[model samples]
Target: MKRISNLLIAFVAIEHILFLIMEMFLWQTPFVIQRFNMTEQIAKDSALLAMNQGLYNGFLAAGLIWSLLIRSYVEQAFKIKLFFLSCVVIAGIFGALTVKISILVIQALPALIGLVVVYLSKPQENYDVVI
Candidate 1:
């Protein structure tokens, strides 16, 4: 289970990193337009907004990495994941209602699964105190 969670977290982190680059840097480029079906003009106009959104995605990835660390505030790691995943879940629902059904599956489902795994896994409390 731990292995699965780790793999999922790693995958999500890497995937979102690429998304961050695409949305922030290559948004107006042909790659994202061809893939996500957005117009180049719109992508260019929204670059800054997309970059902001990408930062949130990066935060989610960071939270996952933090949970993997053994230092204090490990519990805060889970809290961060849960908070962001919950936001994704709500956004998914809104997307399903207003934008498109695919975003729900593509964006939200994996996040939900990852959050569930992180929530179910017991936190590692073992730590050495150096004097």
Candidate 2:
């Protein structure tokens, strides 16, 4: 279960990283345009906004990676994971509400699952520190 959680978290991180790339660098491409269902001119007009959004996505990926590097069966680690996953979920929901419903499925759902998995991924009692 823990392994699955870790993988899910990593997957979310990777997805967001791709989002960063797409929004930051490829926003004007035909493929990217189709993904967002925007016309070429609209894509051009929104390029700056998309780049800003991409930067935020990059930050989210960085947070998730930071959480992974704090490898310990400690409450702090759990809190970090939960916090970042929550950020992803919230951002996803906001994007879905304001931008596109597909954001919920493409961005938020994995984080939501990661949140549940992280909650249950706590190590055994033996691994808990008493100090």
lDDT of the structure predicted as candidate 2: 0.88
Give the 10-residue window scoring lowest on summed lDDT in candidate 1: 122-131
**Tens-place lDDT digits, model 1, residues 9-65:** 666667678767877677778887777778878887888988887887777667656
Score every model by TM-score.
0.73, 0.90
Clashes of each: 0, 0
Model 2 TM-score, 2 decimals: 0.90
Tens digits of lDDT, candidate 2, 12-103: 99999999999999999999999878999999999999999999999999988888888864567667788889999999999899999998
Where in model 2 is the C-alpha error above 4 Å?
123-131
Q: What's the CA RMSD of model 1 in angstroms?
A: 5.9
**Which residue pairs show collisions in model 2?**
none
TM-score of 1: 0.73
